[model samples]
Target: MSVFNQPRRRIVVLIILGLAMVLIARLSYLQIVEKKYQRLADANAVTKKIVYPSRGIIFDRKNRSILGNDILYDLVVTPAAVKNIDTSYLCEILEINKEEFIKRIGDAVKRNGRVRPSVFAGLLSAATFSRLQESMYLFQAGFELVQRPIRSYPYKAAANILGYIGEISPGMLKTDKYSDYQSGDYIGLTGLEKTYEDVLMGQRGTRYIIKDNLNRPQGALENGDFDTAAIAGKNLRLSLDIELQVLGEELMRNKIGSIVAIDPSTGGILAMVSGPVFDPNLLTGSSRTKNVSKLFVDPTEPFLNRGIQATYQPGSAMKPLTAIVALDEGLITPDFGFPCHGGYTSCKFIKCLHSEAGHAANLRAAMAHSCNSYFLHLYRMEVDDRKWGGVKKGHAKWKEYMSRFGLGHRLGIDIPGESPGIVADTTVLNKRYNGNWNSCSELYVGIGQGQVAVTPLQMANAMCLIANKGSYFLPHLVESIDLDSSDLLKKFKERHTVAKISDTAYHSVIYGMEDVIEHGTGRGAQMNGIAVCGKTGTAQNRGIVNGKAVDLKDHSVFVAFAPRDNPKIAIAVIVENAGTGATFAVPIANLMMEKYLRDTLPLSKQPIMKRMLETTTIQLSKLETSKIDSLNATTGMLTSEAILKKYFH
Candidate 1:
């Protein structure tokens, strides 16, 4: 029994010895083989570091210039390692206020993890960085520069079109919908920036590094093996000519309206100008807070992209659609006639513009004369007359025809924030009047008055459809996106047909428009050797001219494409409160067309861009109603007696 117990004790001692050996081997492995854990044990002696890759550049499609930048700089701060940092002297060197210096360092302590460094300030330009780099010892331990990029826009005036960038909002960050974006990242706020954000923003790259006890990066401990190389954003070649765009903006200075031009075949925007355009540069860098706020509060609404955002009554521009509908409905032949014996009075209170006398006219002659009576007659015959089928058939048919031509809905342009022009539906009318829908509603819609509204872009797009013989591409600002070997132009190269009107019907409409610019209302747009085709529209408004409600003025509007056949460009011009379309809008449209077509023509011969500019300046200067000492001399009409009775009574 003693011998057995001795063996058991020996066996137990041997087992204890084996267990001790295994424990020693495990400790050796953890200390030697797993050096990472050993190093982490002495966390106070080492620091973990991350390297941010340089951002990519954004270039214009033409390769003419750089539109964005990946500017890099150092952001310095003190950490646990920098125990002897002279807070007062450091503040002096960094040019920060004493209280700010204390608060920033406190924030760094809260945000920084253990020995991790924090960025107190950033974006030191190269020159300042060079001067500071020589005095590195002054900052000591925790001082370091973390490289990062700044958002940039090279073309300053193109802010409305190019848009500005800002930090991603808290709401945007919380959603996680944009998987690519992280916290404290810049995002496109408006314009092309917002429209093509996904394409512009590339993947971010990161690198790991080891730091010394002083928090200075010792080396690329991982040598960028895990880093992603930043990819440059694809270049966007816009259809806009920089020179023409600048000239267009200068032309529309101080005015309240928009100028829209497009390539008739492709719907490539040539120039889109709105008056009082703010400089996009104002929204960049550290200065944006003050400037952007003032701009936002300004009464002029400088931020509004009037070209595709604002809608107005098309006025006589809708005449083309009206005529097309009338012809298609078989309500009238090309020679359909209506006598405007002054004006068409439907009721005591409702009267057409031609109330004085009527003119003998067919469709062609009616368009030439802008005969309101003729359109009113067509609306009554084709729409209001129950014999032809009343509201539902007429309204539905009109809507179908307009929709086919891409009205009443977003034209689906590549740009963001596009406004779908207002189309008065019978349902909307029924809801509004509780089924008291009468000839009154149909009549106003026929004449492009009342609730019918269209953006300048929609109007220009419609005109381009007409100019292209009833087919069009969606209006797109970006002509192509080329990055690496990928050419995105081919994807957008497909021709989209907006409508399919017959060749004969198209020709008939084209001839009428051609006549408008030549022997009719749009004579203001005619130029030598340029067979311009266009129409004029005047949207009437009732407002307080002085202290009384009166017919204030008409918005002048023009839609035209030049050289008639094989048209190069089409344009729509609208000048708010400018009395006549032919007088105000046509001249501007003519100028734009002339400049675009004859851009290479000798400076002396390039009268179009210049004339367009001068005319806009002259018109805007005349907006001051108080300057009109003798209103009757220019207006040739007195205030309505009803207005006087309403106020002076």
Candidate 2:
């Protein structure tokens, strides 16, 4: 115990006191100065409500609103706050029984905890909402009404294209893909709705409301300091011409097929029509679920979007593609002719459709006449050409060319559910023919038959390629998103070149197509002033029926691009179970072109339009007969008589 020890003890005591004072100062600052803890305590008395943003509207190319929004009311309930409210009176207002009311309350409690609000009845009608609004005050803090937005379609056309929004499923709620979504949220189920879902579904906001002791919202919490404003979704402008869509749908009534038209300039879809389509309004509002069930079970499959989903052998409509390939490979000149004795010498499976003398002709004449033997010979020569090492190598090169044309792969269209048409490669051929196959083994591909299958979209796109002479933009439905940021559509705006072939090769093929409409198999598609370059196809059909292989009627197909020089529209039309390509499909294409280009049909053409509108190839029952007799009486041999003679003869 010296004097220095005493000084050290005093210093230690002073340091301890200073540390204690600092701790007290920090506690005082935290308790009085900061509002974090105060907000935490207030959270117990506040309710956070999610504010759903309104979905964007959809407009056609003409700026017409095709889809719009409608206000709907939902009855919500908090099971814990519910008291001795007149159960019978509430049920009467809601159009439900007392037992059903109890069950709904129990369900709400099970779905969301007792203190949370849950939907009791959703998408209430205007009359029901009005009735409930009068009695809403009597329900007290337990029941409340919330406003929601629902979709409405004014045009009632393009149901398959516009698609429908549906409630989120339990599985979707669990998946990471829908992590942002909660229960009771609506999501796009198919078509363009599903494609642009993220952009169309805007950011959801939150609002904090002060709750009283009875759990009723008193007012905005903290004067709305913590509330975030909801953002409306971005709008979408489509390339679809609603008027043309309506006309195409009308022309395809009572038929089973599809038609797709694209603008050759920008590759924007003008019209996409699938037959047996229902009014788009049927799949909206309160009756959506019921109508969906009916459409699901319908034998005709009205839900199918045949334009990009269904695949078929394109028939002679593929001749133009073959002609281009042949001319590009230096395999034949535009004037190269092939002799045909009514059928191909290498293979007897395909027969010439033209006269024997006419079958011995050049590419343009062969295309004009749709001579099957000519194209079959061209396919064999290209595959057997000695420049490529072998048939396998040559087939691979051919597949590469087809893939460039956007075949054998998805075209990356904005819409969902697009099927990549089949183009046989070396491996596919080897597997199908057991590696011993030769050029003749897959010769049917030359005429766009056998293993080759294509969607109506692919056929139209192939025509687009020919129309543009080699390059094309990706076919797209949505033209622009939002107001000024078309940069979001960079993917579709990029130009894609399928073939590097010379323009001369394209000219040869294009001239052949022009001749097809001028006086060939596709003469039915000819217009007076518009020069339509086209090709007709009658695909052989074989399918399993009643557990046996049967020969069904050929599929009628036609592909064309108008004004041969500066093409505006490229189109493909298909009619299933129809007799010939020149019968039902060509006339439909002719009318579609006339409507789109001229914007009106001439008086002389009204009778032809009437005849087309009246024809029904559906054949719902064997006892039901087609209106081909009526078509024959009005449109002469071009429609029914000549097609029937060619098929049965």
Candidate 3:
């Protein structure tokens, strides 16, 4: 002290004070501001259990539970905590060898760090769970049974619309959409489950318990003061009619197509059925892995939701739209006549079913008869009109009308992976024909052929607008969520108008469709005491086999709206390779409409329903035989023909 100068002494004292202050500040930050350290400290002395709440329940329009959840147990393990224990006893219970146990433990440590827990085995059978529950004390903290909810379908229908849930992938865990989810968590992969996942997924909670030196739970920490209780997920209410759904599935049992029926008044989907559907229960429980593997490999593609996924040429079903567009454009009147000599001669020689004197005498007659020549001439005249300037411009104008009618684009239904069927415009035409194409070059489009294609959803939605006389609500599945109308429900409730077409033009089209069911080609759809308006379609297309075009059977299609005055239901049906629309599509659609309107089919129609149930139109290619066999062998599914005999015959 005596050797030190006064200024140097002051500087040294200040440095000591500064160091003391910094040390105090860091100590305060660690002790008061940071909780991770406290959590880690508690982790060493306490047991943390994740509490999973029950997933949301899905109900139909009648307040019936369509999709529900059941409790399942999974064997979980923590590698770091797996200390001195009877490894062989655990192996015996799990039915595994010592080598497999070592390998699985190593895999668990590698997948996640030694400190974190992992799923050693999942979806334990009830018998295994019961056996393990009685002797869980032996495994203590390292191994535990975790309770989770798995989906259960009460009716075993609407598999396509409901979709399935799967584990979160490593890639998905990194994304912000799934940031809240962790490894081994489940998420909806498709359909309504995917659409309403945010509302359907339950919140997770944590329970902390004090533990002894042996990692055995003593009691709740601080009398459960810091523990949060698990809250069950919100439930969802749908507009789907479960009874109608069951019927539709039965009717479409042996076919390879889809049917969609909508309440035109509210735009609520009544029934959406895709054939070759599997029981949704197959995707849950212990057999889930094997069933999912088999389903993913099946040749018929039961996973494909044909209602909104499959696209087909509208065929004669599009004649009414052509008539409406032409009438709106002032190109044709209600009484406009055409002298079609069994074919269209102006451009392509497309044959017509009706060549009588007055068959094409007016819009109603032409549409009633599904006269191809009449609609083709209408398209040519509308496209070649000077008002649109040129063929390209005229064609673009026609496409605009088609777009307004929800053609050539997605109608925005509440589902995933929807297809916008083909609707060619000027740009597409120019690219295909090098800008030298004229209206006559694509005349087949007028008859809903050539470049025109549509989904069963779109076809049904179009019928909705036509049924409303000008406007329609967007077709949707969910009606409300937990008795509350969400923004999605609000959007579906809004009515959208297609165009400013006169009501008279719609009446003309409606009259023709009515005649189709009453006395024209769609007479098979006739019903007593009901004014049904319908149209038939036989779509021609070629399939590809080894890069060659093969002549495939024509697709049968039908579109209809029943009780014509105040329309109740609008429906569209398609049966692939089923020949004439009157043969397959008409009967199915009419029966569906009858069920929706009358709540049941009469005794007389029972025979017709049986015929539809036992019939099959699926023609598997040689290339798909092996794949189909593999699926049948591995999945225990019946053959395409045998499925009908097993369930209905």
Candidate 4:
């Protein structure tokens, strides 16, 4: 009793006060600051049903719905609600054994806990749904059929452009970026679907329902005051022409390459096709898992969008650009000439198509005939200009001009997985030549070989620049998104101008391109009434096997723009392993141009369309090595020799 002094009593009282403050502060945080515990506490009594909004409909240029939505039924289960019922009957309905049924239940419980509902079986077929619908009342205690909306392609066109969607993966669920997403949520995995997901996927709503101790629904919680209505996703209107897309796919059928067409003025994509054409329907519904696994192992890689993803040496198609760069740099004039006798005399290995003297008398004639020597000489002169100091500096300057033309990089197209095709800078050139290179060392680039590589999309965009005389809009897929005020399309709307070349120089280039379709190598691309400016390219894509050059088929390529003055459409076509550009690419391009310009093919051109549809340049040996050949076989895609004979003969 004597030890209990006043100062000691005051100290004990202060300690008690501090302890009370900490307890109060922590309690406030749990009750007022933390929302997760509150939701969990609410889950004990209130069942929150998520109201999923309908995904946006994707429309083509003509307001035709290419991509829409369809309903799929999923079998969902609540482990806590599972009760005394015919377990054997349920297993029979699901076509699963006892072990599988137990394992699935355990998986569902472990995934989302016993109190919450989880998907036991997803993407149920119509037949299964019909069979289960009649007896759903029997299993009402634990199981329910929930309607899930899925992407549907009505025309079955633009598989690579529209892309596919799937359930969110487990790994994505734990991240803060995806904390809003739940286990059963779906997300766009690629293409325009993934690029505009935020606009395409609308706000999700919630409905609170009161439940009994047995987890059976009692009634709406608080007379549905807590309920929020779902907001449907915004619609997407694209610049794509559905009919053009269909025609492109048909023309490109059985081939391994791409076709890209764009509107020169607006830079809107008209059509983009990556062949062999894959059915978008296969990547949706219950068959998606199996089809995806098949596609994953396919050697041909149908999943790759060749229009933007695959790169190639542009060949002679790059000559016009070479000339434009040289002219713009004041290194050459429109009338400048280079004498040729079968090849470039300086670079003896680089051959020319014309052996006649004075074939390269002028720029227009040289380009029309695709004179290798003239363009090569032009590239060397431009890069080795005295103003640029040396080859390295000149090359860097040349590269800068190329970038302005939208080469050597992605054009920021609306789709994902677009490759920034190789445009060798000094660093790459140094590495390739061990810092001992000169303009002559990379002169083959003038002919679009060597260090230059470009995608079909890039080529098409370059065509747009040429058609517009060194200006272009960013190539874009979506034209507008409903209710969008964020100016997502501002970048595409701005005009980008490159190069300060004179109008006379443009005239020479345009005139040369006109000659190409008129009477040159690209004559097959000619249209009777329209002024079609085009260039043909036969690009080498080979390898060194056993330290020796391996002989392989060259890729056929063509780039063109139509009606020359105030040009409307710009296009690029590539056919892997095809012979000459005139053989496959030029004809396909001509057909596309005629269709777009005239809006109908003349009766005389019917035979050309027929022949194109029946052709297959893809070697059968290559097809046999892929899972696509076997998988496509199931869908009446004839991969056998009979098809080859039928098409070729």
Q: What is the C-alpha lDDT of each candidate?
A: 0.68, 0.81, 0.84, 0.87
lDDT of 4 at 377: 92
Which residue pairs show collisions in model 4?
none
lDDT per residue as tens, model 4, 115-166: 7889998998888888889888778777888888899887777999999989
Query: On a 0 to 1 TM-score scale, where does candidate 3 land against the true structure?
Result: 0.91
> Which 10 consecutive residues of model 3 have the lowest summed lDDT?
622-631
lDDT of 2 by residue, 128-177 (tens): 88989988878866888877778887766788888888878878888999
**Candidate 4 residue runs with Cα over 4 Å from true position:** 1-46, 210-219, 543-549, 625-649
Among these predictions, the greatest TM-score belongs to 3
The TM-score obtained by model 4 is: 0.90
Clashes of each: 11, 0, 0, 0
What tens digits encode model 3's per-residue C-alpha lDDT throughout 103-188? 98898887677988888878898988888899899998598899978999888778889888877788988899898988778888
Best by lDDT: 4
TM-score of each: 0.79, 0.89, 0.91, 0.90
lDDT rank order = 4, 3, 2, 1
lDDT of 4: 0.87
The ten-residue window of minimal lDDT in model 4 covers: 638-647
Q: For model 3, state the Cα shift of residue 141 in Å.
A: 4.8
Residue 106 CA displacement from its true place in model 2, Å: 4.2
Candidate 1 positional error at 14, Å: 22
Reference-based TM-score, model 2:
0.89
What does each candidate score in C-alpha RMSD? 9.7, 6.6, 4.4, 5.6
